[model samples]
Target: MNLESPKVNVTKSPQEVFNFLEDIKNFKSLMPENISKFEVLDDDKFLFALKGMPEIVLKKKEVIPPNKIVLGAAGGKLDFSLIGNIVETADGNSEVQLEFAGDFNPMMAMMIKGPITKFIETLATNMPKAI
Candidate 1:
């Protein structure tokens, strides 16, 4: 299923915002309670464990610093992709668009949709603060 996640407007510049959001070590601090731990194994890869949600061992599929980051993973029959976009506003502020899409296992999909959405919203709102 395709999900439209929240987009948050941050006061920081695009580069600042992007750096904060892309750093995996900061993820647990930015994300909501649902995300218990988010760890970065490298510059472009990470492993995340979610409480009461479908856990993902994500690998960076693409990265174009200060602008876009995409992570992908396979869970059983499901293929998941998460796209994070950081845009520089006209006023030089930053805006983040987080999109999560995947074909998921029936049971796991149903269980994770809401939590995942919450995760995105939390990330959008707190990423700038974390920076």
Candidate 2:
């Protein structure tokens, strides 16, 4: 299953946005106001817990300069990725979007899709504040 967030424009350039997101410690600014817990495990890893959800360890899986950052779940049995895609805009700003993808049993996908989509959308809307 896959869910994409609405693209959001930020005042910073793509490189700046990417630099901020590449740091695990900066993720807290992108999380919802209701975020219950957050911790930086290392340069490429962090742990966060949202209301009503299990604590999750997000480990950076790949980095593509100013374009993309791929993160995966570290401690859960679930197989998924949260991909941040960035593009330089005409106004010297950046356009950011988030994609959430997972391979799950159809039933399981159906069950959690709504919550996951909502989460990603919230994160995307908060993208302008990333830098």
Candidate 3:
């Protein structure tokens, strides 16, 4: 099944939005209790634990300045990727989009997608406040 990605609007500039989301440490604050063992690998990669269900190790895959981020999780029935992007709006607002894609059983998809979407929305909305 195709996963639905959510877009969130934030009252922040593109540069500001980019810098904030690029840091792995920020992810810890956005997760619900299921996640544990969040770690930053060097300056580019991140390793973390997925909470509940079929727990797995998640790694940051790609980082593009002021625009895109990609994360992947593996080690279980679910092998998925989480992508996020931030763009500047004309009126000085920022638009952030979070997308999920993978090959997983329907049951696993149904269970994890919603919470991940919600987490992305919450992160995009509150990220500015953090900076």
Candidate 4:
């Protein structure tokens, strides 16, 4: 399954946004308020639990400075990738886009689509505030 989040216009420059996202632990700031059992395992990984969901570990997978960052599930039941794309706007600010892709069976996709979509949308919408 593939999901795209709304573009967010942030006051930070592209490089600044990239720098923030390069640290996997920063993701905790973007998580929904109800998240519990959060832990920062290392500079490149973190674990958190969402309501009704199994604990999840997110790890940094790849980073292209000032452009993109990719994170994936680490030792979790879900196999998924979360990508952050940063573009420099003409006004010296940045526009960030978030995308999520998950590997799941047809039945599983049907079961989780709504929640996953909302999750990614929330992440994208709240990122600028987090930064």
What is the lDDT ranking, best to worst?
Answer: 2, 4, 1, 3
Worst 10 residues of 2 by lDDT: 122-131
lDDT of 4 by residue, 20-91 (tens): 889767787888877877899998998888888888888899999999999999985779998999999999
lDDT of 1 by residue, 5-102 (tens): 66778888888876775665666676676566677777666777777655567777887888988878734445888888888999999888888988
Candidate-wise lDDT, in order:
0.75, 0.91, 0.68, 0.89
Task: At residue 41, give the lDDT of candidate 4.
Answer: 93
Descending-TM-score candidate ranking: 2, 4, 1, 3
Considering summed lDDT, which 10 consecutive residues are worst modelled in model 3? 49-58
Off by over 4 Å in 2: none
Better of 1 and 2 by TM-score: 2
Q: What C-alpha lDDT does candidate 1 achieve relative to the native structure? A: 0.75
Query: Which has the better lDDT: candidate 2, or candidate 4?
Result: 2
**Model 2, range 1-131, lDDT digits (tens) per residue?**
99999999999988999998898898898898779999999889999999888889999999999999999988788989999999998999999999998899999999999989888999888878657
- Go through the candidates in order and give the clash count of each: 0, 0, 1, 0
Please identify model 1 stretches exceeding 4 Å from their true place: 74-77, 105-108
Candidate 3 per-residue C-alpha lDDT over 3-122 given as tens digits, one digit per residue, 9 for 90 to 100: 544566778887887777677677766654556567766565566656553344556788887788787774545677777778888998888877777876878778867776665566
- lDDT over C-alpha atoms for residue 77 of model 1: 46
